[model samples]
Target: MRSLVLCLLTVVAFGSCLKLPSSFKKCDRKRTDFNQCLSDAIYGALKILDKPLPSHGLPSLYDIEFPDEVATIGNRTYGLLQTYYRPRCIGLSKPENINAKLEFGPLTSTLTIEATYSQLTVETGFEAQGTIVLLPVNVVTPFEYTLVNPTYTFTFELEEYEKGTTYFRVIDSKLDMQAHGLKLDYKQLFSNKILNDEFNSAMNVKWREIFALSKSIDEDVFAPLFGTIVNGFLKRVPVADLFDG
Candidate 1:
């Protein structure tokens, strides 16, 4: 009886000492990478928006109101905005991206935008990919505007898996006013510009805060399930210093 009890205890100890599978370990690593990538991506977008750009001519349109309904998740309340801008030159385009702004009262909190693309194939299967970009569009009051409006364009290929989708979806899109016959009042342009600037600034600050919080949550929640994917992908590719000062 004594020998049997000792044997059972030894077996239990050995079982406890068994190592986790290599794939599981890889997964954990990848998850960490994924969380890091998410953080970097969010922070990177914010950095781009935060960089001081010459405030040229007052925005073509003004006072674009955001949704007032606040969403509370844990200790945070989120506000959202939807806008669409039609490119002067267009070939083919999808709807606007969903731009999310989070707030805690007068202080602006966070800004995030999400867009999705889909590709359908009979042999491979339907694939959908979504990208969420977080940026700080801080609005400063008394914002001076120049008469010159600079045109900007950005293009990047969607991730490999996402490229296969047949349909593309853009959530929370922003529309350019010139196309819609919307004009800004020259007299109220300053005040409107200031308000808009201030709003964007507040949103930018909020974005940074929420992004940090989200990364923490993502790390905790998805680490086990998707860490390996993140790690593997990052390891194979050269990491870029996107947000480096």
Candidate 2:
């Protein structure tokens, strides 16, 4: 979920270079409709990123493969211990109602973006050995999670980096997300069929509780990962060239 969302931000932050594909539209800072233009440009850019653009340092968003991610539900005192290995995510809906704002300052700048995505689906191998809701269970099974109508807000703080030419690098970043619905499916909870079915049923019924419990993962895992990847590409092109004067 983190990598998928930030990939869009990477495209939005990329500067205007000569090698860019014609699909990307640049907005002028002096224009009154700059925000609307920025939103339109970002929507168009994401649509054409179905294939990797090596010249632009962009990867295919058709399927985003992520490294093993480990996260715990609660502290050692108490909570469920959950882990996900080799998660593959797809079905990233095109962003809608996109709004992008860039506040240029003398020393630094801030970029705040708000967008809504229709859906995102994730499938991963899961392991849960610890206690969940006072249930003693150890399970290793394939997990599928889906988010419906998720809206995300991202704010990036940028500073100038000089590499012969002045470029922008993300110094800090924050991400906030809310979803209308969530679907969770993992069949094998225990060796017993009855227990397995009941557990899976409970999870599907109570996914909102799970989401609230794991909400911190956004800040803990997503934000830093997003900042690093955005900065990696954002620093390549001169800041002055990203927008029209």
Candidate 3:
């Protein structure tokens, strides 16, 4: 009877010693274990950025917008341009990926991806209304721009923070994407191919400015849309599901 009491006391004492601190207790698993699992899950999730993209057709993300802007028209000169683009439907498909890499870095719980997409197909119908100045004249323009096959490359960064019990919110995220061979078929408000050609030639002279705008669109527009998709998926799956049993 005495030996039985002693054994019971020992078991109780050992269990008590295993008790975690208050902060750690709040989580579904030990902090280290949870972090490891989350890292692996994050790596897997980032790779989906390269996967076959489905048509995203609802919510505001499906509708892409480009606002009024001004850019250099040519060397040593600036052009004033105003643009409004509203997409009725937009979707991405055909992921031909050359390579992709995902890294879960320790600092700030950051997830970084450096990926290259060989080709992609973008389907869209958007009202594009814009007027751009070359030097002495404003070129009036309005069109329905639709596209087919496009190619892309991207660099991405996202930060993760715990929302509650095994769920996380990714914030302050940014994504940069570049497009190539994207042909926009235009159904214009007015037919003036020669004037449009002149505008295009002027824009080509200031290619650097257009390039900067592309990066801005990626950061200011596409980043949040991508976060919604990624973080929404993360919230659905439990932290336990991230681990290898």
Candidate 4:
């Protein structure tokens, strides 16, 4: 009887050792596949601006859409669906929670991005050149003219990578007028008004230079502009190890 009791006790101990507690058997949350998560996060960050691209010459606030398949990173693919808008003289406010998805094999990751804007406002005040006097006795002359307000929208996208570093390219961009309502003389009380075309031309040239500078990948050319926009996005998202083979 003593020997049988000892054998039964040994069998019970062996069974207990083989059976792990429920908590010990649970999978660790931190051990998630980083490669996959990185891809999802990057795609999620861009989905914030996924709206229809406004047609050229349309003088209103409109959505700027992304392609159905914006990009492919490793074995994953990303796409953007929709965006929101608020028009202003300086810039348009992007919508909240722009929707997007990442697909890797059978896995799908969803994400949201809060879009915002940095504005560059160009304002020109000119004096009207040609004027006419309503009455010879009336010494005052009237000037008739209009004011032009133009706005440009800048968009961004990631392009290439090497090692742990990634490079971005201006994927799709636009230059359009945000507001074009005419500004006219309220009262025909003044005559010596003159319009300055030179100033307007100079302003346009400045804007072109700024846009060109934004596109240049050279550190000297684009660093300042990149810091303003792309850097923020990069900081918010997780980048995958570009060297992963």
Q: Which candidate is the best by TM-score?
A: 2
Candidate RMSDs in order: 22.7, 7.9, 12.2, 21.3
**Alpha-carbon TM-score of each model against the true structure:** 0.16, 0.81, 0.48, 0.23
Task: Give a tens-digit lDDT track for model 2, residues 125-211.
Answer: 878776766777577888788888977777899998665457888989998878888888785657788877787787878878978
Off by over 4 Å in 3: 1-81, 87-91, 98-108, 120-165, 179-190, 197-209
Ten consecutive residues with minimal summed lDDT in candidate 4?
69-78
lDDT leader = 2
TM-score of 2: 0.81
lDDT by residue (tens digit), candidate 3, 55-79: 3211232233423222222322344
- What local lDDT score does residue 177 receive in model 3, on the 0 to 100 scale? 58
Distance (Å) between predicted and true CA of 137, model 4? 21
What is the full ranking by lDDT, best candidate first? 2, 3, 4, 1
lDDT-superior candidate, 2 or 4: 2
* Candidate 4 lDDT over residue span 1-245, tens digit each: 98777656744743211121121112222444543544344334334224321221112222322122111112111222111112112222322222222222222222222223332231222122222232222222222223234232333334443322332223322222232432323133333233234433444445545344322322232223423344333322223322122
Clashes of 4: 11
Worst 10-residue lDDT window for candidate 1 reads: 119-128
